[model samples]
Target: MERIEVIFKQIGTALRIIFLYKIVFLIACFSITTGWAKTITVCNTCDIASLKKAIAVAEAEDTIFIKKGTYKEFNIVVDKPLTIKGENFPVIDGEDQGEIIRITSDNVTIDGLFIINVGTSYTSDHAAIRVVKSEKFLIQNVVLEKLFFGIYLEKSNNGKVYHNKIIGDAQDEYNSGNGIQLWYCKNVIVGRNIVQKTRDGIYLEFSDNITIDNNISTENLRYGLHFMFSNDDVYTNNTFENNGAGVAVMFSKRIKMLNNTFHKNWGTAAFGLLLKEINDAEISGNTFEENTVGINIEGSNRITYHKNNFIRNGYAIKVLGACYTNVFEYNNFLYNSFDISYNSRINDNVFANNYWSSYTGYDLDRDGIGDIPYRPVKLFSYIVNRTPETIILMRSLFIDIIDFSEKVSPVFTPDNLVDERPKMKKIK
Candidate 1:
């Protein structure tokens, strides 16, 4: 007609200017995401005075979704960058003078709560999610039963204490405490938590680049994980069971303990890992099972104990007194009543190609080694080193007739503490 109605009015004015420039770029991204959408919803039949007046009129990227009963009120103070969730798991009964969630907020997130009476102290570290001087915080799936110190991170940093469940019916460590206590924190990442009957189920002092992996620190009244002077850390695959001494790394240094599982730390100054004054360390593939002493290296220096798996311990590796230049290679000293316990009868440490489930030498022409020399310090460990009541006749037969007459004349232990390439069997 008239040039097809002027090409349909010039393609309808270029499709209405491309639909008004995509509706003004979607209203400028919904006004920059509704300017950080603030949300506040609390109702367990409402009225804890209107849920503390909707968390005191929330702000800074707000979110206060607290809908589940038992908010028996205590000193609830959360200073800003909010997000105080608790869809269910809401019980903050702090009837013990103050503290029941006192976060001084940077980017806060105190999820699913339940914090019981925690007000004790000679100086007050009363907690149940108490992060003072906060930074990027996140205390996940919370549950802190009848506590004093359960998730107390003072002077916080880039934090992330995940999957929390801290129960502390702690009977005397002089009035229980510490389930996840970190002081002067740093870039922390404590994962998969389950800290029990506390008095120490994860206590780190002077914390640094911490990374405690896959945790399940059991039965605690002490040392389920106690780190002093903490340093560049990385404790992997954790499971420090039957506590009271299953993990303690004092005066720490560059530590990297992989595949961890330090078991039952039994009495008499128990130890399933107590490396005091540690230096450049690396204890790989760990699994010191039935422990009563399976790694108690003192004044550690240049440490390195590879491929570890010292099962059934009653003293598997106790090198007391100023230890130096440590190295025990290809380890697997199973069924240990005493594989290596040196109180310094002088043997500058190094037990090669180890695998001594009581290695009785002789591999003849089979080349898998052990044609003798596998003397891992017995002789009833020198009669329990001068009768600690002779260790209940350790593997009897009069301690195997004086450990086979001190393994053919090498009297009273540490005769160059051998393990010469001894792997004729049990390397499992």
Candidate 2:
């Protein structure tokens, strides 16, 4: 019995020794396969002075730390996974030649770089930084100036663009490009960016599942934020101000726009928000102040506009035609030239629980609901739509008399468009 016990103990000891050897062998193989990632410094007096040279010799998953100096290089391609970091925001002056950086590999990050003077080309859209078909990429804390297109993302997904400032000196829309453009991208987040003076501040085309939050888009020559054929996107807490037009969401469905401010976007053909061919959208908690038109709707259906404040606008909500099943509830319309303007006599929308500053109806029930229904559509607005020159007499007593008569017996505007449960006070 003693001899058998010794034999079993020796067998167990041999198995333990073999397991330890296997672990050591696996560690050696891993070390050989993935060499340690190293940092390559680029400076004027360093061995690698130029950014192109640093990138040429860099292995995958390496860090290229560029010191503070001007690098006059263009069309620099990043074809491997590398983090190109700049200290004190190094300047990459393209000298009006071509694109500054083009990222084509996955898991690449471009941080703390100031890029300028991207080439202008009518045939191709030149950009300061362009990410093409890259995934898991990050572009943050970068400044772009004097660029044709500031940061362009083409067919890229699962990326983030954060805290970048893009300033352009765009004079015309025909020759200028957008600040940050996303084409055919999905699952991208654009946050905390300030884009100004571009043709369009931020433009998205054919992109889906995008989150655009906390962005300030101002002073653009065209729309501050333009969306075309992009669906299932949400833009929240953004401020669009002083642009030619605030925002245009066209041919998109299932969009959620919440807590955004649109202010001072005034022009003859300007509006705070334009919705065309949009469906199943939610627009809530927005403030539109001092704009030509607060919201312009055309051929949109199944949208909900709730908890919005439209103050001191030329027209609060202008319904062109073919808008159906839309609900405007719990909104405050204050001191507008015209509260609602409908070009069509047919209305299939619901207006409920809204507060109008011009409402004279009494609330006898004391339940915070007005006793009488308020009709928002005025006859003068309809006349002005047909003969825009008649808008000159908007404040005249003659226009007021005609508007009172139409309220009694509606003829030009949609008769069914009345807030049944009008709120006595403004919604908080």
Candidate 3:
């Protein structure tokens, strides 16, 4: 009977210990969900003078407010879920040491800070801010300058980068990095950012489901916006101007490029837009102006070019090879040196209902369409393809005679490559 009494006493102690554990867990969860989350302030005269120290003692869901001062720190890592905000635009100077702020946790937020002087490394991609393998992160209202890379997201998902300005004084492409770069990231929204003088203003590789909207990327050494191996991305209301080769989309599929402007991208090899090996894309309502070549397409297929305006370019569209099933319709080609240049003799793409300023055909019945078919590819363009130095005689009367002869006999240019229903008036 004494042994039975001892066994019952042991059972009672175990039950009491379990009850105490439940109470402790409930209190810890309540601190996170209720109003128990703390706010830590970092200032020059405070107890926590350093941002690194405030992050050290901060709990999950705490906010760290940084006051107005210059903090000479680098390699600061945020490994917990916290909100870091600057009160009066505090400056975080990296002194060209390394990456400034690196976030490795989910639900992290960084806002209203000015970061500069990121270290340049050939082996490592140092950035002013780097978010790696994190989800639902927000980096907004920051300014970055003198950067190797401004904001880089690697393997991150469901993030938003908004209202940031990144300025880089990049002279060459060998050492310069992109302003905003995403690698293997998905479902990211990048908006209202101004990026200039980087290698490529905004770059993406192996990323998907990204929306890049309302951004201005210009004056870079390479492309203003570039993407490769990315799919299901949408870029709208962006302006890409004065870059080396404006924008290049290679090896991508299902991309929607709408309502963007590509202007003043001029060089010997520069173009407003370059599409290489891309398929099933939509290029609509965009403006390509004053470029050497408006759009250079190579090995791209099934893209719909609709309602775009190509103005004052050397060649409005230059097709290299293996481009098939692409539809060009309802677009305006105005004051271009050449409307279209095709290298191959076979014509597999469709060009219909486009307005050409060089079209001299008459509409006899006034049905809002030209009665004669418009041959976009001229024979001089074919000769310029073989001998580029012959472009000096582009405006001479001799070149015009040969182009008319080729139109009459259909010798060098593709005979079937003609717009049957050319629009009599410009497309609105």
* TM-score leader: 2
As a whole number from 0 to 100, the lDDT of residue 57 in candidate 2 is 99
Residue-level lDDT for 156 in candidate 2: 99
Better of 1 and 3 by lDDT: 3
Q: Backbone clashes in each candidate structure, one number apiece?
A: 0, 0, 0
Task: Report per-prediction Cα RMSD to one decimal.
Answer: 14.8, 5.6, 9.0
TM-score of each: 0.41, 0.92, 0.91
Candidate 3, residues 41-67: lDDT per residue as tens digits?
999889998899999999988999999
TM-score (C-alpha, index-matched) for candidate 1:
0.41
Full-model lDDT for every candidate = 0.83, 0.95, 0.95
True lDDT of residue 4, candidate 1? 100
> Local error of candidate 1 at 141, Å?
14
TM-score of 2: 0.92
Model 2 agreement with the true structure over 88-153: per-residue lDDT tens digits: 999999999988899999999999999999999899999999999999999999999999999999
